[model samples]
Target: MNFIPQFTQRSAGTEAVVSLPHGGRRPGRELLVRALIGLAILLVITLLVWFDRDAYSDSGGDGLTFVDALYYATVTASTTGYGDITPVTPGARLINALVITPMRIAFLVLLVGTTLEVLSNEVRRVLIDRRWRKRMRNHVVIVGYGVKGRSAVNTLHQQGHDLNRMVVIDNRPASVDEANLTGVAAIHGDATRREVLRRAEISKAREVIVTLDRDDSAILVTLTVRQLNPSAHIVVGGREGENVSLLRQSGADAVVTSSDAVGRLLGLSAVSPNIGAAIEDILSSGVGLEVAERQVTANEVGNSPADIRGERVVAVVRNKTMRRFYDQSVDTLQTGDNVVVIRKSEARAEKERSERD
Candidate 1:
């Protein structure tokens, strides 16, 4: 067997030798300074012990040693009085009072400084992460930080989308801070401006979501984003019964009206509450079931919904009837049938991953 030196073996066993040099080097330096200060305090106690030993012994009947003085200083700094060691002479008491007061003040200062440094480091880490996330490209930029925008961001994040790749552009500083706290890259800027859109990496973004409450702002943002990046997939939110044809004409790929969707949901609930509950469960991200529309190519499945890449097909909206496509043996998937696939969000994510790759 090869001979390994004891120092080398101990170094490998503890791993401390490798880490000791770099372990909180700054804190170590501070600790070293404190240790030197403590040593100087002990040296002062030694000098005082030599000078005041006779005076202390005259009152206590036992000579005051260097260790006794050092112990007294430590106890006074920590605010833990043992009552066993008492200074009797006026000179000794005066010395104790002078040294103990400064030691207590120094201890308090050190404690506050250390606490503030720890908090400062944590804040710096969060700020750095926020800055790094803002600089990333190919992100899905959400133009608003309202309820709709927040809901969309939460859904995407819960679906395991990278928060760094999902940038939030809001006008309010509070909204930006909220998004940043959630690890979502957020910048405070007007979405209607081309410069603001550029700052959000509009040209490089894969998707742009406009969820502003103001219809005019939404329309203007849509137009601007389309003009800036014609190829980006733009999704806009509109009010109830609001004509989004102009928005679509302006180049939004999809327009979602919350008023219309909510009205429809309420109507469905009035008719069949269980069905509405099921629909809500499917739509809710927490339920893990997503009602996703998958486009079938002519060459891929030969127009067959049964051949789609999922476990179950809930319904096929063909001829606008919402017929059951679960057990249907249709040979061809018609061009217009929006295949409603009810499956786990993970499955949809996997499908998206495959398509992207």
Candidate 2:
């Protein structure tokens, strides 16, 4: 099914910018700058004609004064030559032909350019949005851009995920601005609302991360997203461990207890520093060690997990069910199975390539 995103204003008052399309100047500011430039052009003409007042005549049968010079400049630059004031000298006429004409042309171009930009702004945004939407399948939708959301994005980025495939939704304008500054699309609205989720294309997203500050909000957003996209993998962050099951039952594929995780790590660090540090290193992405999942290769099929070189197989996933390496159901590697392994982040591919060679 093809869905086209339309950014319609839902309010009666001044609307906030929907998207920072090109991250360039605001339309109002751009028009103001162009107007200033047009005025500068007019000022130059006025000064030029004023300095050469001797070479000009006025319709009142008097010498050309500063007011007459200004009047002539206004009419001439606008291409509305009233002929009330005429340049009589050969030098003045030459200056008009060479300098004034070009300035007049430049002024017209600026005027036309400003009009075109204003007229084409909507069209440009629509075209860009169409193109972006067409390529946005299986993208990630982040419900919040707070600390957890930012850390999830940073971790994904470290694991070589494309930042362009991410979209952030935040109720705070500051979070939206910060998200845009990172080159990712952001929508400013309540993520728990269905309309806001539709704007983020949540139905087509492969993964939805709900990291709202409140656990109840996260559960609500998670439920809403699951209703919109049942197939998407939803990971939620809960403030307390007691609400973890509630978040999961709300259709989250995984739930992490923020306080419990931190508390356990701190306690482990006090008891066994080295083991705690190692666990932290593995949890932190793109570092000394990493945990990742991959499909079992043909060569590894029918062999024992210990025979696989370079990677330590921790679990085998079959039919979406995970089994530890010591499980009897997965003693022998199978063709259509995925293996979760722990390996050196920097040398993961190098070790596998060496094994193949």
* Residue range 52-86, candidate 1, lDDT tens digits: 76655323557667777677656656668676666
Q: Write model 2 residue lDDT over 306-349, tens digit each, in one string.
A: 78898899999999999999998998998999999988885555
Off by over 4 Å in 1: 1-135, 293-303, 307-310, 314-340, 344-357
Clashing pairs in 1: 303-332, 303-333, 304-333
Question: Using Cα atoms with residue i matched to residue i, what is each candidate's TM-score against the true structure?
Answer: 0.54, 0.79
Q: Cα lDDT for residue 153, model 2?
A: 83
- lDDT score at residue 58, model 1, on the 0-100 scale: 28
Instruction: Estimate every model's Cα lDDT from 0 to 1.
Output: 0.69, 0.82
Which residue pairs collide in model 2, if any?
Answer: none
Which residues of candidate 2, in runs, are more than 4 Å off? 1-33, 53-72, 81-90, 158-160, 171-183, 303-307, 326-328, 347-357
